[model samples]
Target: MGRMGDATRTVPCDAVAVSSIIETTGLVMEFPSTRALDGLDLRVSPGVTGLVGANGAGKTTLISLALGLLKPTSGGISVLGLDPSADGPQLRAMIGYGPERNVFPDDMVAYDYVRHFAQIRGLPRDEARSRASDSLYLVGLGEERFRALGTMSTGQRQRVKLAQAIAADPRLIVLDEPTDGLDPVQRDEMLAIIVDVNRKFGIDVMLSSHVLEEVERICDNVIALDAGRLVAQGSLDELAGALGGVDVEIVEVADRRDSIDLVAQRLVAGGWTVARRDPGLTVTGENDEEVFDAVVRAVADSGARIGRLGRRRRTLDDVFTNERGDSSDRPSTARTGGTE
Candidate 1:
């Protein structure tokens, strides 16, 4: 559930023996007037990684380039240390992909779809079918493995895609929005399966999603993208620690919303800036002792009973939005790009 990447080690060349699951440098992508990826750099270790970003934040582009589905206009790219452009077949064969986009044959059964990819990855017909069944079982879709793709629920179909990706026993698996369209229970189940695959089966994973909570809950490492560029890359703690400010939540008694203004006055008089406090709750600028004392005194004086007070940690969204806002504030002409 924490970040898993470390940049201290160098990438090896032979994929068959490659220790680094994925690596890219100065990776770039173009789309008419827009650049989808700019001088991006990325590295992934042998565990679950969260590729966190928005839909158009070059997340798809990064995956495509990394998977050898799209060629980079410039810079180096490799998955399992194999050049995706020149060694696509081998690279793909070593890696499994569950695309974010829906591009399935609606008429086919889940089993058939998975079996086809497994066979393509060079398994014999019987072996492919067997592995296909096994993969579907792993994703919790065993009962619907032979169900027509169009008839299954979105969650079921999502698992079908996952099964196909993992059917070949590849060393690495990439899941794009694996939890999309799933209920919380379904999401938890799917995540458990993914964790089992990574921890129990020893397969590395690269997961892409815009959901910060989901990523924060499951990923071992994170590579965050924003506005078609790398904004930050590291563990959750590292990024959260980079914050100069802190988050604090203050709670009060019932029907005491108007007490907020008085509370604010007390906090200000005590030298603390209250970020927000409408009624029963307040967010302070920081979580230091000075801020805490001021908030406590303010709540006590407001005559509103205190329910709870706690320090709030910085979330992934906060870090990314701040950096992206700064980037957007800069003059366009002054911008320089890079990739990950």
Candidate 2:
């Protein structure tokens, strides 16, 4: 099989115009037992966007609404300038979807499965066959294209799902938990393919995943949801800002504890918040320039050799934790109702 990234064959698909790939206002979805979405507003542009949330945070419901599978309880949504409810068929024709579940038929070969979907998407029989072959090779399944899906591993099955999604050459692709059941190496491969799909084909992508680190790795923008509400939406750099502090690592010394204590005392006197960490200290102040000066003064006053000093970059996890106001180390699993 050809490496996914090495495939130079271009599939036939038109690039979408630059516009709001997805936009929604006051969108809500209510179930019999509870509300899944609550007055959510989102304006996502064309690119790779990460749809992030805890379980039951309306990520799945929102994707359904975008695809026109389910009508909303209130408000409006526009995908590719077409209303999903009014133009469901046309909208779906332009969008490719890879669902989270293993919904493949066990008896079908990979090529036949992808070709079937391509034909269903209105491709001619001959074009469907060609697209299927190219897509399978693009996903590193060229050698396995004739193998039955039931015989494939979980990672290989995921690649098959991706191949079928792109075989029709849709303008946009939406993936849910695409890397759910893969090992570290497999996960990396899948992520590279997703990125290549967008980079090479110009297909806009809305990736829904619970793994924040994976989202941070590839997504250009992030939409973070909490309990069916929009908690945060911005570029990764905008959301994960600098920690507003300097991390200091002190060189080992005979009186290490005493030196750390002295530095802490000096920083506190300088109106800086000092928190002790193993082998280091975290100092934060209102002004970055002043904070830097305070840190240098503290280290010098303590007569301690400085090992390292630098600002720390906040991660998506930190943003999610702070936004949710949940201090638990475990990832968020807050649910509203029904399957997420």
Candidate 3:
């Protein structure tokens, strides 16, 4: 993982190499019946970081706590170098929030709606109007800025929410399920806009979503939560490494189960971990040679004709699935860290 000199450091595991833009230590949030967050400790870097988990994974509650909209039962959090609990206004001014729900007023014009929030957040009237217009354009809503929000499509409304979140030019924008209700095409568009918001505008983003593909596409780092505990946190590469080292998959020819079995047996004898999966066998080793040599020797010895053999990088979906198994085990309330 690449390291930046900023306060935000990339965390592969428990050891902190540098400070983070957002840091939480022993953060806990308790509801009447269950805990929304339990001794949660997380560190986030400045780039786009995807917060991913199953439904009710405390993703929303975590964002709310970071925004200072909800108070944690205990622990500390720092966002943009300031404590969210202590310096709420100051910290919030630097952080824009887009909730999962559509909170926009149907009657208001898009540009006016965005400008009003900017003004409320301390921007002068004229400045708010200017920034709102600019942000709307940035989010590809320039043509629809004058239109009523209620008349727009779901994708358009989502864009409007994003525009308003960035209207005040906050240092960090927290997006909760930004692609929640869009179709595939609209989802792609929204993700593109998110990429531009971070890359072109040089703004930082914390995107929380259950769509693993979206996160995989746009985020440089990911923080996965399960049962209010950090399932994993690090750059995408780091997380992949943590879950499992590099992986290689080999598929045998049609109706060649015996070939794969022999390959697995050979690999295991070579002191390499191998997993039997549908259509193929997954082999893992310390290096490419170790994995490749085993596969080669096994295939040659067993006379197993290969259909496809190559290294495959694990996706966020794989990591999430492997880390948190069985959707039935995930709770609806913070009890199982599924929802909060």
| TM-scores of the models, in the order given | 0.79, 0.82, 0.78
Higher-scoring candidate on TM-score, 1 or 2: 2
Range of the 10 consecutive residues with the lowest summed lDDT in candidate 3: 331-340
How does model 1 fare in lDDT?
A: 0.75
Candidate 1 matches the true fold with a TM-score of 0.79
Query: Top lDDT: which candidate number?
Result: 2
Q: List the residue pairs that clash in candidate 3.
A: 56-338, 56-339, 57-338, 227-337
The lDDT for every candidate, in the order shown, is 0.75, 0.85, 0.78
Order of models, best TM-score first? 2, 1, 3
By TM-score, how accurate is candidate 2? 0.82
lDDT, residue 179, candidate 3: 81
Off by over 4 Å in 3: 1-19, 241-274, 285-309, 321-340
Which residue runs does candidate 2 get wrong by more than 4 Å?
1-18, 248-273, 276-280, 284-310, 328-340
lDDT of 1 by residue, 128-202 (tens): 999999999889888888889988887787788889888988888999888777777777777888888889887
